[model samples]
Target: MQTLETMRSLGLLTPEQYLEITAYVMVNSTPEQILAMPPHLWQAVMQADALLFPGGPAEPVH
Candidate 1:
């Protein structure tokens, strides 16, 4: 799973911008794809979704 800190460090994202982008990605991405992510990256993706859109509906899980 990628942390906000690590994503920032990796230049994949900045801590602040990652929240929305990660959520969008997670909603669209498959469970298998997400599961394949490193632990820190997975957590960051989940946390980003939860933070930006608490209780919000994700994209259809396909």
Candidate 2:
């Protein structure tokens, strides 16, 4: 989950988004594979994270 930590630090994902995405990865992939995923692939996941979660992305914070 270090990549997730990095993603959070980078502001690509909020804490809630990180938790949701972490669960998705845990269910869909082996830990070893997740650790091996390239940075670019992680970026793709970040891009899609909000959409992948149930109920989708939040309505704007405004």
**Candidate 2 residue-wise lDDT, 1-62, digit = tens:** 77576766677777777776677677669878776656755665657565445476669977
Among all windows of 10 consecutive residues in model 1, the one with the lowest summed lDDT is 1-10
Show where candidate 1 strays beyond 4 Å. 1-31, 58-62
Top model by TM-score, which number?
A: 2
lDDT of each: 0.61, 0.68
TM-scores of the candidates in the order shown: 0.39, 0.44
Runs in model 2 lying further than 4 Å from the true structure: 30-62
Clashing pairs in 2: none
Candidate 1 lDDT tens digits, 1-62: 35554655665555655665466456758777657766665665666556555777678978
Worst 10 residues of 2 by lDDT: 45-54
Evaluated at residue 53, the lDDT of candidate 1 is 54
